[model samples]
Target chain A: MREFQLIEKIFKPLTKGCDAAQCLADDAAKISLKKNEELVISKDVMVENVHFLSDDGGFKIASKLLRVNLSDLAASGATPLYYMLGFSKTKDCDEKFLREFARGLKSVQDEFDLCLIGGDTVRSQEKFFSVTIFGKVKKWQILSRNQAKEGDLIFVSGTIGDAFIGFTKACESMKYFSQRHFFPTPRIELGKQLLAKKLSKCAIDISDGLLADLRHICHASKLDAEVFLTKIPFSIHAQKILKQVQDGGRVCSHPELVSGSKFTTLDLLSHGDDYELIFAVNPKNRKKILHLAKSLKLDLTCIGEFKKSTQKKFEVVLRNEKNQKIKIKKFGYEHF
Target chain B: MREFQLIEKIFKPLTKGCDAAQCLADDAAKISLKKNEELVISKDVMVENVHFLSDDGGFKIASKLLRVNLSDLAASGATPLYYMLGFSKTKDCDEKFLREFARGLKSVQDEFDLCLIGGDTVRSQEKFFSVTIFGKVKKWQILSRNQAKEGDLIFVSGTIGDAFIGFTKACESMKYFSQRHFFPTPRIELGKQLLAKKLSKCAIDISDGLLADLRHICHASKLDAEVFLTKIPFSIHAQKILKQVQDGGRVCSHPELVSGSKFTTLDLLSHGDDYELIFAVNPKNRKKILHLAKSLKLDLTCIGEFKKSTQKKFEVVLRNEKNQKIKIKKFGYEHF
Candidate 1:
């Protein structure tokens, strides 16, 4: 779709109170100030062949992950008001590139009335895009990465690791898991719905691997976590395929499969791909949180608990064949 | 000199409420609910090689031009709030590479308290950084890029294009113009101090060359402009060197140079170096604006007036031997 058409078809319907004929049509965006509430804004970058690849399917690459960034605002339960977009126009960025990227951005913006405010455009040898989203919440009501308590239970929303499995399957044969990999939905609905109600004192998106990210909350909160091994959610189809892979003689050589096995179904708990929420809630309020998730029509899963710092209980635990707890110091994925 | 030290030396000591340290040092930043203001946020990218190359003098590449991005807030009278950063650590990025980048980023951040809230890190074949800044302003005072009046006078803060010359000089000898090219002072003091009072009806940073950016404001405001050629400020040094170059035949033979003669001093004016404010003010408030600038200890120049639009006007007038207005149709540097 053309730029204007893409906005018209996808973005125009999403925003509110914007001077559409002017701001959306022009090169930069316009701002209107409404008082009360603090604004919490953030920007993140996703690079081609770095954070994602063209082989992953460009259309989905452009769209699904856009939701991943938007999910940050949702995690804070801040109403997304607008966005400033930065695009790296690479050689591979042609009509299709522009069309899909625009479509993805427009659809996400529409989902939250996140207006295209102002950003920069530049040519690069490779493709990349960074979007800054703006949102607001009552200062006290907003959740953060630093507020988890030791006694809180770690919970997640929706299914975990399905996206990772989807990515693997897509790589195996461009089939079956297109939607999972391409249009992985952000838990915006669940995130926004969870705001201000203090069941999970701390929150963040599962953008990086799950275990790696949980460590972020733990580190920030200055607490230790003890995730139950069996409670981790594994999709039914994924469990079956993984079993077959494990039974196959060649499975051990494939690191992901063994990585999956070494952790039992639980380390999949730590493996990334679950865009589901991984937040902290007090034991007393667990029922309330489950009730809230059900009311919001989002799945709620309780898989772990945060404990007071042990001079050293910060390990990812998995049950061994001997029924002993084995610690894996290296979690799901390591960052560059 | 180093990332951690820079954060400790410059940013750590800054006055912050109990929340700043708790929230910022963690993976996120926190805001106490005291302030209630409308939020106006934006993000801009400056890619390496694409936006600025090492040849562009490390320090100037570090500091000065980045202000062009901040000028967006100044135009809207929004205070500098916080900045989100994205830097790709390339193979070429050694300690010195980081030092310069950090120095440049620190200078701007210090000036604007555009606190470092959150960002991403990655490795690239090339080094580049993109920044997204968030600011706040009251509802009534916000400026839109598309809101110029029919007869509004177009004014710019300071002279246009010095940064442009510094850019060229940096290319010739990075060590020579490093001050001008690398450490571009973002005029934040002037932006914050003046626009906070609503002296200008509309304002925008002169990141792109003057003529094109003015066109944008005019287009957005639904008006046409008639800028005076003589009023356009050219630095004394720019005039001397350009005239010398033209006399020797270096510039005289080129149509691009000859055509852009009216804006010739543009190495300062037309190039994107001068991070000055280009804005439109209602004719009635011109005296008040001048008065406000004088009180604020800032330089405010009335470059030209915005006129009714039947057609576009070429305001960068030059004089021939007969002293007639010389035509300068093609305008300043085009980023795209």
Candidate 2:
């Protein structure tokens, strides 16, 4: 089928009743916001083999691409509204692939209340997908990474290291762990709650590992951070894997999982791909946030605190149970 | 430099005083619209060796990517406001490339009164660029391709065949035509005049050639088109090339320019990459649009008229000076 026909058949339904989309027949899409609301925009690009495995199916690839960008909106405490997808795929991609991809996109759009407004599809040698999401937030309720104060306590929602553990479990064909790596649950409600109730001034969705992303907030706020090693949250599955690595004195039995040798509590904290929310709150708002988390039924863990930085540069200090700093060379992945 | 530092040193200055951009240090950017205004959004993706040559410098590649999306916004009479860029490059792409790319972006943003908002940068095996542009238009002044009515007079802004001519001239090292192909002047003001003055109900940008884009309007509006070959506009450079093709009997001296052997007026109309404006108007509004065009100092040509389609599917009829139908086999480029 031709590009237009493919888009019409597989993608048009994604627009549904959105008048702003113009049924995808116009050169561009139109969207109008209600008064007192501002548009939040973010774009995320994912390339095959780099962002996802070459064997990943269309549904998984599509879900991961959309969810990662949605996580960005979640970081800003914005509601998902509309998005434009720029997709390029090799000739090997066929109608069935597009059908499943569109199905995955539709499912996410329905779940998130987002409409596919406009985008472009082209041919490329490899798969390159970029999602530009436009969401909405009350004018004064928007959150930023630079708003965290020096004396604020840092909090994280949801368990960390599950995605990193999932990456290691992919070799074992552990569907649950692998799926966790593929599909991240963006903390949209938690973010909105933090913003609307003024529970937090600064927040960042964990795309880069916790420590790395925390460094971003601290750097932007001109502060330092102290994270307690025992305070870091990990899923039961991740904990089990970490136990096996330490007790057996072996990282992984599978030869393909060579990166497992790098497994450590610190590595779990530093390995990227955790799409949870890490944020900062004023000390006075701790009780209120705990109550809010319970009411929202979200797992919120306080792992660290921001401190006034004497060097005027951000630094993250990892402390053991005795509050002694540990010597670690690498804290996160660096893309050059 | 790491990703964050790369973005800070190269992309942050593009944000300057735009508070909505969050200084490019946040997860997303925010934009607010004036009362009664709607946002116009469009995305265009360009892949290396497909949309452009692999050897094209960063400045030219960046200009092409941004300008293409701007053309989409101009088709709908939207005033440029802000844009997000999704860029992926191989390991070989260095700081110098980013500096030039950002410079090109800044130049275009300044000329269009738009700001760099938010986006993503990632590493890929090849260069892939996507630009998502957001523009604003008054709700009632917005235009669509589906609004064209039967008996509507068709008008095209500027020349049509320059881009196709430029593609052929690339081998001859002809700067003028090649530059036209590289840098298209989007009819932003003309589109605004047509919509704000209510002179045209429907419009489309000529990207997939004039005939192809005209067909898109007709197909969407449930109408057919009658294009007068002689009335189609052509730039002076394109005219000279066409004269050479007709009189010299030598399509091109360079073997690399063998594609020029396919040169014909019909070929010019059918080829893609002409980023001009094509819109449908009520015949009575002709005098007004002409006056508006004159005042705006833009070249406007009436090349066709939309007619009610009896068979439902749209068709384009190419006519000669004697009003005789011409047998044309192709309309435009279609990506599968």
State the lDDT of candidate 1 residue by residue for B234-272, as single tens digits. Answer: 656555656765565223222224432332443454556
How big is the positional error of residue B170 in model 2, measured in Å on the Cα after superposition?
5.5
- The complex in candidate 2 yields a DockQ of 0.82
lDDT of residue B51 for candidate 1: 67
Residue-level lDDT of model 2, residues B1-336, one tens digit each, is 578777878888887668788888897999888879998989899988778765667888887788888999889899998888887868778878887788888878877888888888888888889988988899777878888888889998888877777666533467877777778877788878788788987889988878788889888888999999999998777777787777754364323346446477888888878888899889999899889989989888898899988887798898999999999888886665
Q: Give the TM-score of candidate 1.
A: 0.84
Off by over 4 Å in 1: A1-36, A110-113, A170-176, A249-271, A312-315, A320-323, B1-22, B25-36, B55-59, B170-178, B189-198, B249-269, B282-299, B311-325
Candidate 2 structure lDDT: 0.83
What is the DockQ score, from 0 to 1, of model 1? Answer: 0.36
Q: Report residue A292 deviation for candidate 1 (angstroms).
A: 3.6
TM-score of chain B for predicted candidate 2 = 0.94
